[model samples]
Target: MGIGQSGSKFAISDLGFVSGGSKRRDLGLNQLILAEIGPIKGDIRRPVSCALIRLLQDPDVAVRLASCRSLCFLIGDCNVSEEDFNEFLPTCWSACFRLMEELQEFDSKVQILNLISVSMEHAGEKIVPFAKHLTDFFQKMWEESTGESLLQIQLLAALRNFVGSLGYQSPICYDMVLPILQKGIDINNPDELNLLEDSVLLWEATLAHAPSLVPQLLDFFPYLVAIMERSFDHLQVAISIIEDYIIFAGAEFLNRHASSLAKLLDGIIGNVSDKGLLSTLPIIDVLVQVLKF
Candidate 1:
C-alpha cells in the first residue's frame, strides 16, 4: 500500500495527466491505474475517489465503462472496515448514478448495471441506504427505454436484482414495479414476443419478491385476459400470473374483483374448444380453486 500520507493527493494530481490524452487506450490505461491504486480508508481516499467519479462521466464510452469496472474492482479490493465502507458508499453510488444517467449505449448500460450488482454483492447491507436512489434511477431508465428489447431485458434483469438485493420490504418493492409491468402490458405487441416474454419474466420475478403486489394484478386483468384470447402463449403467461396472484394474495383478493375475474375466466373457458383443453385446463383449475374461496 504505497498509498502514503500524500499518496491520494498524488493520485488526484496524476489524474490530470490521464485527462490529457483523448484516445481510448489512454483512458483505459488511466482506469488500470485506478484499479491498481484501489480505494483506501480514511480522508486520504476522498480525492482519489472524486477523480474516479469524474472519470465515470468521460465522453468516451470505453473510458466510462472501464471506469465503472474499475470502481467495482476498487470497492471489492479495498480492505476497509464496515464504518469506512459506509463512508465510501456515497461516492461509489453517486458515480454509479452518474454513469447510469449519462451512458446511452445498451452494452454500456448493461455493464453499469453489472457494476452495481457487484457493488451490492460486496457491500451487502451497506447497499441498503442507496436503494431508493437506485430504484428511482432504474424507473427512469425503464420509462425512457423505447422498444429496445435487449435493453428492456437487461433493465428487467437489473430491476430484479435491485428488488432482490433490497428485499421485499424495500419501499421500491411493489409500488414502483407495478407501473412498469403495466406499461409493458400496455405496449405489448404480439409480434414482439421477446419483449412480452421479458415483461412476463420481470413481472414473475417482481411478484416473487413482493407477493402482496398480487392485488395490483387486478388492474391489468382485462388487458391480460384480452391477450389470453388472442394466443395460447399469451394465455399461458396471463393465467400463470393469475395463478401466482391467487397463491400469494389468496382467493379473497380475487373475490373482491369477482365479477371481472369471472368474466375473464369465462372468456378463457369459452375459448378452450378452439384453443384446446390441454392448454387451458390448468387455468381452469386455478380459477375453480379461486372461486371456491
Candidate 2:
C-alpha cells in the first residue's frame, strides 16, 4: 500500500524482469517515476520543471532521450487540470519542435526517434502546424539520395514513427505518409532501405488509424511481394516490418487482397533457407493470423 511495499513487490518481479532483460526494467522504472510525477502544468513547479527541461540538452544521448520520453509522457497525460492547456502544451511543443529541428544536423537516429515518439505521444494535436514542415524536411532529404546516409534514413524512420505514434490521426501525417508508400513501389529505383521502411511505417499508421487508405495502397501490393523474393538481405527485418502493417490493415484489406498476400507469402516461403527459414517463422505466423481475420 505504501511506496515501500510497491518497491518490494517490484523487486520480487525483478527476477522475471532480469529474465526478460535489464534494459526493460530500467525503462519500466523510468516510466513509473514519470507517471507518478504527472506534469508541472498545475503545481506551479516552474523552477523544478525548468531544471528538468534543461536535461533535454544534455551531452549524453541517453540522458536526453530519457528526458524527452519523460517530458512527452508528462505533458500527454494532461494531469494539469487546474492549469491552462495553452501554458503546458507550449512547453511540450517547444521542446519537441526544437528536438525535431536539431535532429536534422545531429546524429543518433534512436534518440531522434525517441524524441519524436515522445513528442507525438504527448502534445501531438498541439503540434499540427509543424507536420507540414516535417513532411517537407523528409521529402527533401529522401530526394537528395546522395549516399546511404544512415543518419538521415534513421531520422526519416524516426519521423515516420513519430507521425504514426500520435494519439489521433492527422491529415498532415496521412499526406506525408502516402508519398512514401508510392516511393516504395518505384521498382525502377526502390530505395528499399529508406523508402520501404517509411512505407511500412505508413502501412502501420493506416492500419491503426485510417483503414480506409488500404484500398489505395493495394496498387503497391505486388511490389511488396517482389521484395520478399530475395528473403535474405535484411529479409527478416523486412518481413517483420511488413507483418505489422498487414495485421494493422486488418481483415478487409487481407480479404480483398488475399491472393496478393498469399503470393507474397509464397515467395517468402520458397526462399527460406534452413538458417533463414527460422527468421521467417514469425513472419509466416503473422501472415496466417492476418488471413484468419
Candidate 3:
C-alpha cells in the first residue's frame, strides 16, 4: 500500500520504499526506517507487522536485527496501545525466537535479548499470560548456552526486566536463575567480574520483587556474607539484601548464619573508612537489634 493510504498525511514512501526491495542492504535499512517512524499508521499496523515478521527472519543478520529493533521502537514509544500491539505479539515473539535459535553470534543474541527485554517491559500486564512460557524459555536458554558468558550476561540483564515486570510472579524464573546467580556472584571466580554487577542487581531485584522466596533463594542468602568479606564495593546492595532477608527470611535466617555474620561485621567495623562506617552502621544496628548481640 502507498503512504497516502488511509488519509495519512506523512510521506513515508522513502522510508517504506525499501520494504519491497530485494537486496539485503535495502531490507536492513528499510527495517530501520520503519523503526525510526514507530508505527506507520494505526490502520496499517497488522500488515506492517506481517511484513516485519517475514523480514525478521531474513537471511541477512542485519535485516533480522533491524526488524527486531523496529519492534523494540514500536513497543517502547507507545505509538500503539498495549491492547492494539497485543495482536502482533505472538508472531513477533515467534520470529524473535526463531532468530534467537538460529543465530550463532553472541552479539546478535545480545540484540534479540534486548528485543525480548524491551517487549516484556512495554507489554506490561499483557505479558502475564506468557509468564510460564517465558520462564521456560529462559531456563532452556540458560541450559543450552552453557559456557557462553557473554550471552549469559545479556540474559541476566534481560531477566531483570522480566522479573521486574512479573513482580510477584517473578520467582517462577528463579529455578533457572539461582544457579547462574550463584556463579555470577562468586568472588573466587576470576571470570565473574563481568557478571558480578548485573548478578548482584538481579539478586537485589529478585529479593525486592519476588513475592515469596523460593527454597533456592533462601539458600542463596548466605553468599552475601562472603561478598561483604571480599569487597566494600557491593556493600550498599549487600545491605539492602540483608534487610530483605531479615524481613522475608526473618529470625530463622539470622539464627542460622549468625556466627559468620558476626565475624563479617567485626571485619567491616575495623577496616572501613568513616563514611563507609556510617553506611555500615544501620545494617549492623539492625542485626544487633534482631540478634541481641
**Top-scoring candidate (lDDT):** 3
Scanning candidate 2 in windows of ten residues, the lowest lDDT window is 12-21
Residue 77 in candidate 3 has what lDDT? 59
Best by TM-score: 3
Give me the overall lDDT of model 1. Answer: 0.63
lDDT (Cα, tens digit) per residue for candidate 2, span 1-293: 21124334444244222233344444554455465543233333332234335555555446556666665555445352323333444454455555554454444434545545555544445556566665665565455434654554565565555556443554446565666556654545636655555555555454455434445555556666666664445465556556655665667666666787677666666766777767767766876776674
Return whichever of 2 and 3 wins on lDDT.
Answer: 3
lDDT per model, in order?
0.63, 0.53, 0.73
Clash pairs (backbone) in predicted model 2: none
Order of the predicted models by TM-score, top scorer first: 3, 1, 2
Clashing pairs in 1: none
What is candidate 1's CA lDDT for residue 262? 73
**Model 1: residues >4 Å from true position, as ranges?**
1-64, 70-89, 118-126, 147-149, 170-175, 187-194, 234-240, 256-293
Deviation (Å) of 282 in candidate 2: 9.7
Candidate 3 lDDT at 293 equals: 33
Worst 10 residues of 3 by lDDT: 9-18
